[model samples]
Target: MTGWCRRVRRFVSGRHPPVPSLLFAAAWAYGVTGLFAALDPLAARWRPGGGTAVAAVTVFLDLLLMRALDDVRDLEHDRRFHPERPLPAGAVRVRDLVVLYAAGSSAVIALNAAWSWRAAVLAAQLAYGAAVLAAHRRWRWPPGDRLLVNLLVSLPAPVLLHAYLYAGYLDASGHGAGWSGAVAVVVAVLAAGYTELAKKITRAPRPGEPAATGPLGLNGSVAVALAAPALSAGLLAARSQAPSAWTPAALLAMVIPAVAGCRFLLGRARRPCAAPALHLLLTFAGYAALGLAR
Candidate 1:
């Protein structure tokens, strides 16, 4: 048991890094939910409470669960390319991740079940995640070798998660999503997909590593990366009740991705990968602040 615990710890440290992962989860949960509550005319006065806390915990666990499942699903691929990763290095075993997924998913389901109608959304997310795993294991149809197709297939997971968060906010506030909710979900999804693409737009990827540069080329990849956040921000501004207040922040946030793209073009590869992450974090944080200020 001690050895198993240690292995899990190794995996967490090497792959997930608890501190940043928790921060990302909390930011996503609170930031997205807060934005929905603040932006939705019907839920403008909604504030975080017990349901908010529950949602944060659920997001954190769901992230860990997804990480575990992905690591397991890609174990063979990692052995070929990322041999030093925890699972490939023998620091963690498949069964260890399986246990983690089982426990974490059970907690997620139970938490959402007790909280609100968010359970139905959570169920759909879980079903989609399971189907992805099963499909990957059975036939590998999406083909990890094709970065674009694999990313497209993977996009729904985050999209469903955003929907789940929106649903939780609605349930807690006793409101309907309306068109505002739909717009917020689209914005959040675009932000997420943009971040995913941005991180993969490296000029010099390690051999066999999946990168958008390979499929879209650096210029094309960077262009698409820049486009997503811009589109997302435009939608938010159009939908926002007080666009003047948030528009500046949105514009400033846009500079991060642009700078990151320029850095990639200039061959400064080391730090550019982190740009989208910071951009997304700031965008979400800005949204939460906007909601609270209003």
Candidate 2:
């Protein structure tokens, strides 16, 4: 029992540092959910409810599972390059992480099943995640191509999140976003990809690290980041039923991050990673708040 407890501690502390993880998870939850709220006709106000809270929890768990799996799959690389990380530092073992991943996956399944038929959406998420991990392990995508790699890894997150929310909303409201909803989904997915790219490119790479931004040069990456919100705003404006209160605020929220991204690219900022992460969070939260706000 003691041994198992110790392993759990190491695994949780190493793989899931609470402060940062929870913060990111919170931001991500709100951000993607914002998209759902914006499109939901029944959401007369921008106030999150039981469904939103449930979705947030599920999204957080899914992200946590994916993070653990990535560490497990990239154990060798981490050992070589990121030896201080929990897995590489021997603070946690692969077997322990596997168990953790399995448990987390089970929780996600249970949560989604209880929420509604959203279980299928969660299953699809798991499948995509598995495929991505498999590719990373087998194909060895170019490390220098961090933008594409990050996009491939992170895109499914927003998609699955959207699916989960949509599944519940449709089940409850018996409606869909139709063509406008589809556009919003595409916008959200692209924002997610750009956000992932920004997270990578903003950080000044260590000397021996792979190219930080891949084919997305500093300028290009920042541009994409800035554009994500702009495109979202355009789409929202086109929607007849888009939440009026959230629309402008969300656009402003996106602008804040975009400007910060610009600063990082210009070397005015010392580092790139933190700001972009915050930016992504705000964008999601903006949409979520708008969607739920009465």
Candidate 3:
């Protein structure tokens, strides 16, 4: 048990930091349920504890699988560019990671299966992940194409999460998230993409190093991030069900990255720093609160 715990720690340290991962998963649970509440309050009404557990587990497993796959795929690149990373540094073996991945997959399947037929949602996520990994193995896109690649890779994430929640909610409440739920899903996807772009904004790359997402500079990244909230606000407004719930969050979402972008522009900071990510975490909380508020 001790050895197993140690390995788990290594995995967390090496792949996903524990604090951020847990926080992100918690926020996601709230946001997903909150969106469900907004779209269909009656449908969203269900046993809180069970719903929370399902969302937390689904998000955590999704993140874990993504990190593991990325680590595995980028083993060589990490060895060269990020030598201190666990897999490249020889702190953990690929075999161990594979075992963990398999175990995680099983757990995800079982959790979703028990929750509902929603295990199929996780299965779709797994399928997309596998396809991306296969592509990475075959043709490594140039760094210039990194932005597009990142977007494509992440596009399915919101769908999977939504499907997971939607399926479970249906099973529990015998109703669906409705059309507004689609808007929430779009908002989630755009938020994720924006965060991806924000993280890749580099304050300073070495002489030979390119911008993290190729040619996308601070301004472009910020713009990408800003677009999410603007669109989300519009969607929330159109729904008219709980505009109050999402309005502030949408505005704040736009503001956080915008402020970070300005700082990056003025040379006050390098990259968007952690502002965009932190904002995303807050947005999740806001959405969750909005759900509960309703």
Candidates 1 and 3 compared by lDDT, better number = 1
Model 1: per-residue Cα lDDT over 149-181, one tens digit each: 878888888888888888787777775668888
The local distance difference test score of model 2 is 0.66
TM-score of each: 0.91, 0.82, 0.86
Poorest stretch of ten by lDDT in candidate 1 = 242-251
CA lDDT, every model vs. true structure? 0.78, 0.66, 0.68
Ranking by TM-score, best first?
A: 1, 3, 2
Q: After superposition, how far is residue 34 of candidate 3 from its true place, in Å?
A: 0.8
Runs off by more than 4 Å, candidate 1: 208-211, 269-271
Winner by TM-score: 1
CA-only RMSD, every prediction: 2.1, 3.1, 2.9
lDDT for model 3, please.
0.68
Order the candidates by lDDT, highest first.
Answer: 1, 3, 2
Q: Write the per-residue lDDT of candidate 3 for residues 1-294, one digit (tens) a residue.
A: 566557667877867887778778877876766766665645444345676776786788778877887787778767767888888887777767766777888888887676446788788887777677767777864233376666666677667867777666566567655676676777666666667676666666655555664555656665766676667656654553454645565455666766777777778546545786787776676566556555
The pairs that clash in candidate 3 are none
